[model samples]
Target: MRISALLIDDDPILRSGMKGLLSMVAPEVEIVAEAEDVQSGIAAIEKWKPQLIFLDIQLNDGTGFDVLEHFTQSTTRLESQVVFITAHEQYAVKAFRFSALDYLLKPVDPDDLRSVIEKVKKSQDDATGISHVELLLENIKRQTNSFKRIALTNSDGIHLFEIADIIRCESEDNYTTFYIRNNKPVLVSRTLKEFEELLRDHGFVRIHQSHLINLTFLKSYVKKNGGYVIMADQTHLPISQRNKERLQELITKTL
Candidate 1:
């Protein structure tokens, strides 16, 4: 299947290199237009209405974020899938992860690019909801440490949840089940390890190999028989010895 695409970047060399790489790896992705800045990028998008966009985070006139904002705030809906190409911007990267948006780090790797292309193909069949993009924009507007929303994608669809609403997470192999307040549990395909990294700073602790709990939802830590924690929903989850001390330290800090 041929995918119409636009490349928006300030560096002509990088744009040329990406075009070359795409020709070799993703021959189906046809580059319809290229732009060097926010205005031209927006103009190209309006003209081509490409199926995919490879956007640079930093442009000559304005950032790629400016381009997205221009469309997101307008009456027109951006139906195209965006892949942000960026250097090491830690805060922006975290926001993208929280929003469940796709991004590529510079300089791009062939394997990673191929993986992204595969994801794009899969997304075509099961398109992600526009809520993901809205959540991404919301996250970008907040202080990194104060990001309040997260997007979780499963077979059913993408779910937007307030970070504080999550009670705990349970792992079964590569999947994680999120227990939320006043909502049904959400099963996500992503690994517990991935969530552990993403949510650790937001008052979440991996108490065991199979259990991650939100500190705000922790009811009590029971020491009878074996150590375990009681959650807001009264579900008991075992605590592993390896993480016991860390949990205790965090609990003390919270108190």
Candidate 2:
């Protein structure tokens, strides 16, 4: 399939360079539109729903993420994937983690462009770009030891859930609900599978397809009549036969 693309950059020279690189690297890919600022970018996106977006971190009017938020809002579902082109060192590393999409440094090189194209191709096949992104973010979190809390938003506003306070992750339909400390669960619009991979190092276990519990919060294990974990909440999580052994092994090590 031919990939459609949009370019959002304030620098005319850089945007031209990226357009030229993408055209040369993947002739099949086509640039449908270009924008110089956040407002124009959003308007162009609304006009042309491209498959991929080449986002610049800094725009004339606002930051690139601000541009992203306009689409992520109710107006647009952020249908296309984003590949940020940025010079901000602080967010460059974090960018790759938040959005698994590739990024090119300032003064874009043909070699870097080629590599990013290859990564995008790989993502097109894996269909797990978001998962990989989350894993990358989790890895970053481990390395930086920053923000040991999860942010949640509901009708009232936004709330922060301490990572230590969460017992486990549970999936219902398309959302992942966090079981926290004596509080109502925080409902986020993601799957348990995603969180399971995101919190792998944080003692989360997918004992069942529908449940991902924090083994750290586990209180007791019952072995009779198929196995189940009894968490501190007194909530029982059934363990599939296939996972019983692995769960036991992890529990042993944690003890």
Candidate 3:
């Protein structure tokens, strides 16, 4: 396929190197345009309408997330395959993996870049690929320590859930079953710790290694059976001895 691409990054050296690498590795992909900042990136995206975008996370003018927010909110609604290129090594990367979004770490390895290009091509052809982008955009819009939605992948496809609607999560081996409001419980192929890291700041507590509960849905703590939490749905979940004191503190604060 003749893939048209836009490179949006603050570092001229990195962009130039990437251009050369892309030319060598994926000659079919044509560099349509390049931008050094979020504003120009948005302008280029609107004007060029490229098939792929190599987006940098940080820019002098604004973060790459700013550019994505613009496109997401725009009425015209342009969808392009995005491969985030960043130096940031943190929670954002975990979110990317959870959402099935593609990202390249800096300093970019030629082999990894080539692999990402191939993945982008494959993702471009998949019907569900764009949904991952939408999920990532939703996550990017959230403030630190606060999130409104979570995207989970099931056999059918990606499922989006409002954080407020989720009551609790239970671990079963590698899978975590999310108990949600007005919907059947959805099982996702991920560990509980992964979710704990993403949701800890957003009022989710790990009452036990196998469970994570949203504080909003917590009704009361029962002293019986060691210690247990009563969710809004009246389901009883055990609280770990190690986490008991911490959960109590949170419940007190919530009350």
TM-score of every model versus the real structure = 0.95, 0.52, 0.69
- Native-referenced Cα lDDT, model 1: 0.90
Q: Using alpha carbons, what is the TM-score of model 2?
A: 0.52
Show model 2 residue runs off by greater than 4 Å: 125-145, 148-255
Cα lDDT of model 2 by residue, 125-159, tens digit: 33222333344344344544343655454344345
Model 1 residue runs over 4 Å out of place are 125-130
Among all windows of ten consecutive residues in candidate 1, which has the lowest summed lDDT? 124-133
- For residues 1-255, write the lDDT of model 3, one tens digit per residue: 889999999999998999888889889889999999999999998899888889898899988878877765687556677889988766678667546567899988889988887777766654334466677766665555455667787666678888788899999999999999999999987799988887787789999989999999988889987989899989989988999999989988977
User: Which is better, 2 or 3, measured by TM-score?
Assistant: 3
lDDT digits (tens) for residues 101-171 of candidate 1: 88999999988898999899888754333687778878989988899999998778888999999999999
TM-score, predicted candidate 1 vs. hidden true structure: 0.95
Cα deviation of 108, candidate 3, in Å: 4.4
Which ten residues in a row are the worst by lDDT in model 2? 125-134
Clash-forming residue pairs, model 2:
none
